[model samples]
Target chain A: MNRTLALVLYGIGLALISHFAIVFAAPYLATDVVIARIDKVRALTPNELRVAPPTSPPRDLVPMGNADTITASSWLDLRQGPLLFEAPLPRRGEYWSVSIFAHDSDTDFIMSDRDVQAGEPARVLIYGPGQVPPIQSDAIIARVSTERAFLLVRAIMRDRNDNADVEALSAELRQATLRPAP
Target chain B: MGKVFRWVATTVVALALGAGSAAALINFGGAFDARIVNGAWETGRHTGSASADPYSRARGAIYGLWGLPPSEVVYYTALQDDTGQPLQRSCSYQVSGGALPARWWSVTLYRDYFLIENPARRYSWSSTTIDVAPAGNWRIDVNAAGEGDNALPMGERDGVFALSLRLYQPLPQVLDNRATIELPAIHRGACQGSSS
Candidate 1:
């Protein structure tokens, strides 16, 4: 009922709004940069797929994408597909390796994980050559001219460290491939 | 009278909200604290002797779950604690007990989640080439660009480095009991205001 009281109430409302505004607006105000997917998700190298080394590992490894990022077989080939890629599904406790490659100007950036979840059993992304440059050489991966894509592969609980099991990957449909544009 | 109630209610609500906000903003232990070092949140018992406010501990744990993968992992974001202490950055410290990973381990530093190209032309260190104390337990220094140049390196994060400890296929001895394995403090190098 008093003017003084009304003014105080108004001030409180203003303060609340100001605080909320700052908290929510920050993300929008800040520019969000995109991370590129550098390497193609391939099979495993023979060495990486091997289960027992002369030196056995002491414990089970939550295998990250050091090997499966590429195909172990030299003759294997993958191409850019529709925006989505269709890969093998992973069984329970299994996850696919995923990498986010971002190239800023000349610098090449890489983020890879063996655990890109294929839990849903279908559909993943394969950023095409335009999105990811092509493979120039062993050391350099170029942006393929064909449109790249993303795919979801079926992940299996099979032991990644066991090299013997990986041989099956080449034969079975368990592994998914991204193809170059038709 | 009606206006008075309205104002009183508004003031009470405002103060309450302010108090809540302050509590969230309040940070407990500085970066070196084990629980908070993983992130802004606190951590569970890591078999260490350190004091940290409970609130900070909980917050740091939540952050760790999100940023950290499963088990204990590290990152080097340039953020400060309540007392304005440098906690995490692209640079960090990692130590191991009893044969650090016979299968290749590295303390890799990254600017963001992605590794950065540095003038040092180096991205990480492994069991080999990495200089350590003869006892096997060792410590390495990390900083953003030049950290020791000033006051605890607590200012802007520009041109700074962030570090992460990566143990690739860690051997059993180090993995099973990493918490007990002592980690040396991340020191500021050759800076005027840093703790050296």
Candidate 2:
């Protein structure tokens, strides 16, 4: 083969290898930011929702957050065992959603207030890979593929005058608990 | 020895160029290309889904969005006015539209991916809160000075800003034919100083 042709092939081969490597690694690297934010909250209190301060400019941790609602987040480490998730049911006429994201940023599951059966507080059992949960009555069971995951909870805020109500909802969410299954 | 050195050098350069270019393309390319443009507003129909390509996934990661699938929520963003001019903080703009077909929706102002802080501590307006005209239309003023009722305070930041319109639980037709949806129009208004 000609020297130039050999060099071209070598370069192309290397480029292809690096391209795939980056694509596969990007999700892990991108997830690092979320992990760090979760760690910060976990440092304050483990296995509980840490409500972010109402939307303000220049907050480094949470990006693209909606100002129209109050947001709270929590990190779950399922290595120990299955964890019980519990939150207060939103008041009537209010919209709330709970979204769980896998380590790769995929939306594993989402449950809205509308999805909850009437008269049931938001409660679920999150199971990690290869873990089985004890039978529980009247609780949602979600099996997650990753050992680490995150949850984003949002509740509607009506207007500026509704700051107090929003704060109340935030406090209610912060009361949410994630504990090892019995 | 010389041939081995040449191969190693080429491999290093090629890997660097390849990874760097791929990252740039994922970050800077038209990653949000599943767009439906209605005047100045543009929304990606398939932004946060398993179907999204690697580039879109990378962009969503950078923005810290664990994007909901289009069936749950649709996000429309605009960085320009109806005239195709960039939205500047130095100038004011008006967003006017009627009700959207969704269970709920909101319009938010952001500068550089973060909420624009103001004295009122207000950064967005939702359907339930915004005042509607007798004819069922609504108007919102986007100004740096926070003037007028229903004003979205743009703050004093001197740079381009963006508007994100979020529709939660949109109707089936709106999601199926997002390209032809009638989103709010952003019209350029008075200016305090020269626009950048």
Candidate 3:
């Protein structure tokens, strides 16, 4: 065996170790970029969840009979909790919302306009894959009961500026007033 | 000579170990998505400590990292006008909020993405006007039609029950969309005892 050949092999090994160490230490040398990015940006909240459960829970429940004058009331109780209305909900302006009784609870949230399919049960999700974090009234619920259930609703008014007009319109809808037909 | 051989063996093992750990980190990190949408990344979080039901917390953490602007979703909840009036199922909902899109925007409804077939002709918005709102923030009504009303027919018995809100093309400062939006609380319906 040649002594020069052995020494040359040892030199090659030393170079490789140095290279590997540098590569391994690169991340630490680069001032924690990932950590800094995380620190600088704030985490966004799921607006849907926040809206469903406001800072304080509503502390009352009342029943409307077969013929309750919804228009006469200051505000109606909502049926079902936030879980019923799915996420990525539309802001309250001019769309219709449905209220349903949560299966085993007394709470309720307004249904989003997206889930109101005629002739089917509303069964929307609260959160799901590739979806925005807001909840809406369009979820298809499995069933609905009219026994003074909870109801929280938002509407998308065709006329944003006509607040008083829209409020009157909403009251009219709630009243369900109909004229006699010949 | 024996010591040298032992040292070489130990170095090889250590290298192998370090390589394995780095590989694991990359694999786990990839599971989370980070592509930008409408100039910002939209993601989720399930941090509601009330129910630690399975993937809720994990999903919540992922949402926190996405860094997208938040919009108001507070209006979607069910409750009376800051009172205890029981709302009903046979009603419609109107939604509106936030600024218009600069580079595309949309509003979608989901029971956690299990979308329902709305009675209305429209389902979501990526481009333009809905039921109608003068503000850049739009609104649409979700319910059955009637007089003096431009309503989209609703699911008969299956009318809307629960829902969520999503804002796309969100402005940068709407960071506290979650904390700031004025949402209603879920009030319990009258007890069966009261109804009976």
Query: Where does the lowest 10-residue lDDT sum fall in candidate 2 chain B?
Result: B27-36
Q: Which stretches of candidate 2 lie over 4 Å from their true place?
A: A1-6, A37-46, A132-137, B1-9, B28-33, B192-196
Scored by TM against the true chain B, the candidates give 0.40, 0.87, 0.40
Candidate 2 residue pairs that clash: none
Q: Model 3 off-target regions past 4 Å?
A: A1-182, B1-55, B58-88, B96-105, B109-113, B118-120, B125-127, B131-138, B145-153, B181-196
Q: What share of the true interface contacts does candidate 3 keep?
A: 0.00
Please, what is the whole-model Cα lDDT of each candidate in the order they appear? 0.34, 0.76, 0.32
The numbered model that scores best in lDDT is 2
**Regarding DockQ, does 1 or 2 come out ahead?**
2
Better of 2 and 3 by DockQ: 2
Worst 10 residues of 3 chain A by lDDT: A60-69
Q: What CAPRI grade goes to candidate 1?
A: incorrect
Residue B2 lDDT in candidate 1: 94
Candidate 2 C-alpha lDDT tens digits along A1-182: 69879998989988988886776566657777766764664563545677775665655455667776676776778887887778877672257888887777767778888888876778888888899866656778887778887777877766645767767777776766767876
Q: For residues B102-193, what per-residue lDDT tens digits would candidate 2 score against the true structure?
A: 88999988887788777777788789888899999998899888787679988876765889898998888887777778899888888876
DockQ for all models: 0.05, 0.56, 0.02
Q: Could you tell me the C-alpha RMSD of candidate 2 in Å?
A: 2.9
